[model samples]
Structure formats: structure tokens, C-alpha cells
Target: MSIQRIAAAATAALAAVALALAGASPAVAGSPHFIRNATTASLDGVSLVVDFKEAGLEAGAVETIQVTAHLDALYQCVNNGGKVPSDPKKTTISSDVSESDEFTAAKNGNLVGTLTVDPPDAASVLDCPSGQRSTLVSVTWSDVIIDDLTSGASLALTGTFSA
Candidate 1:
């Protein structure tokens, strides 16, 4: 299976699972791991909960970041007790890369994409807190477009992981 597909499945399954922090432990190099973070955003009648997974990392090493944008629920103001359009399954969420878009989400709400975390960004997002030793996955949904919207199409989110 494609990497994206694998990531999507993992993300969906672990959406509600939280990983406990190891409490100020030194990050071991060459170890694969998972970090989870989430943020909520709303516009018009639709609400989104953006979940992030920083996976496949070895301490300060750079790796792929998985993003998931979920439609809060089927019934909302626009839908008026009805389901949203049948297009969320086709909606694509991308991570910004050097003035371009990269890492589109898969069909199952898993934007299975990898981002190379540079030194500066890495220092902020990947660095664990004083009493924590887990990666922080930051996700800013500035340009994520939910195509095939009939109205109230604008959607944006600033979901960052706090240290």
C-alpha cells in the first residue's frame, strides 16, 4: 500500500488515542515515534478539527508530518439537520512547501504527506518542553481548500503545538 494510505489508516485509528509524555527524557537518536496534536476551527456552518501526527523521527531528525482535517459532524447550520455534501471524501489538504503546496491528504481524511523540518522550524515544533520529551506537530490550515462547496467555502486554521 502507498505510504499515504498507511498513514491515513493509522491516523484514523489513533485519532482519539493520546500518547503520554516521558517527562524530561533525552531523545534517543534513530528511533521511530509518533506525536499527536490537535486544533479546532470553524467557519460559517462547518467546523473542523485538525489533527497532526509527527511520525518517523529520530530525536532532532526531520521526518514526515501527517495532517487530518475532520468535518465536525454531518449535521450543521448549513446542512440544517442534513448531511454535508458528498465531497469531503475528495477534499485535499496540503502542507506548504517553499511557496508551493505539497503532501495532499488521502481519501480517508489522512493527508499522508511528509515535511522536512528545517533547523528553525524544527527547533520550534520538534523540540520537547522542559518537562516533556515528545515531538510537537504544528499544523496551520491557512490554504486548505475544501473544494465542491456550495456556500461558505472559506476555511482556515492555525493549529500549532505548544511546548
Candidate 2:
């Protein structure tokens, strides 16, 4: 009876080991972790709202996020006695900009937040030629991306903010 019990236990252990090995998978280290609840970036009025997350960071880690983008801004300028509808004095200017901010990661390595971009406002850009007045009508941002400058993490965002 003792011999039969030992043999049964050994067989069961071997079968369990075989099943566990069949279900195991290789771990992919250094891969970017994606957050499911992140919101899509949007433009609020004349400002842009950056909503996103950076994964694979230490819990409560303080990090700097850098944003680089191409911007197309439309400015309406008053032309000296220019035709009202026929000669709408509007100018479209394009530029590349880089911005940065710092934040702390969550306990689960997700750094999430909303960034409001409204500064670097070029009211002076309204300084039109020939004593004309100008105002920024609208702006379009493209190929916008965020990078974890502190941790050197991979890209986290690539959304276009336009009205």
C-alpha cells in the first residue's frame, strides 16, 4: 500500500509540471505599458489639452515630459483700406515648437495628467504691417509627440490638436 501511494503522488506531480510548462510564456522586458483609460488629446477654445500617460516608471517617480510639435497658426490682420471680403488679410504661419513639464508617476507606474497649453502667446504677432491690427484666429498642431525626458522612455503620444 505504501509503494502504490508514493507512485501515485509522483505521477500527479509530473503531470502538474507538464501542464504548467505548457502554459508559460516569455516575459518581454523593457516594453512600453499601455494605459487603457487615457483620454484623447483635444483643443479647448484657443488652448490645447494634452491628456495622456507614460508607463514603465517607478512609483511616485518625478519626471519631465517634453513635447515637440508642428504648429500652423492663422492670424487675421487689418489691411490698410483692404477690401473687406475680397481681400481678407489673413496670414498662415507655420512653426515647430518644443515644450516640457514635470509630474510624478502613480503607484502602478502610470504618469497621467492633462496639460493646458496657452502660453507663448504672440499677441505681438498681431502687430501687423502698416499700422494694422492683428489677432490669432486659430491654430493647428500636427505630429505632436511627448517623450519622457527624465527616464528616456519611448514616445507616448502622437495626436493632432486642431479646431
Clash totals, every prediction = 1, 0
* Lowest lDDT block of 10, candidate 1: 71-80
lDDT of 1 by residue, 1-163 (tens): 9999999999976764533343444444332323333223233212223333323333343333333333211111112233333432111223442211233323222332332222123333333324333221323333332211211112234443221
For candidate 1, give the lDDT. Answer: 0.31
Evaluate all candidate structures by whole-model CA lDDT and list the values in order.
0.31, 0.68
Runs in model 2 lying further than 4 Å from the true structure = 1-39, 78-90, 119-122, 129-132, 156-159
lDDT of 2: 0.68
Per-candidate TM-score against the hidden true structure: 0.19, 0.63
**Pairs clashing in candidate 1?**
105-111
What's the C-alpha lDDT at position 120 in model 2? 40
lDDT of 2 by residue, 1-163 (tens): 6999999999999999999989875332344443545635577876666677778777777888766667788877655564333455676778776767888887777788766665245455555556555667778887666667777764545667776
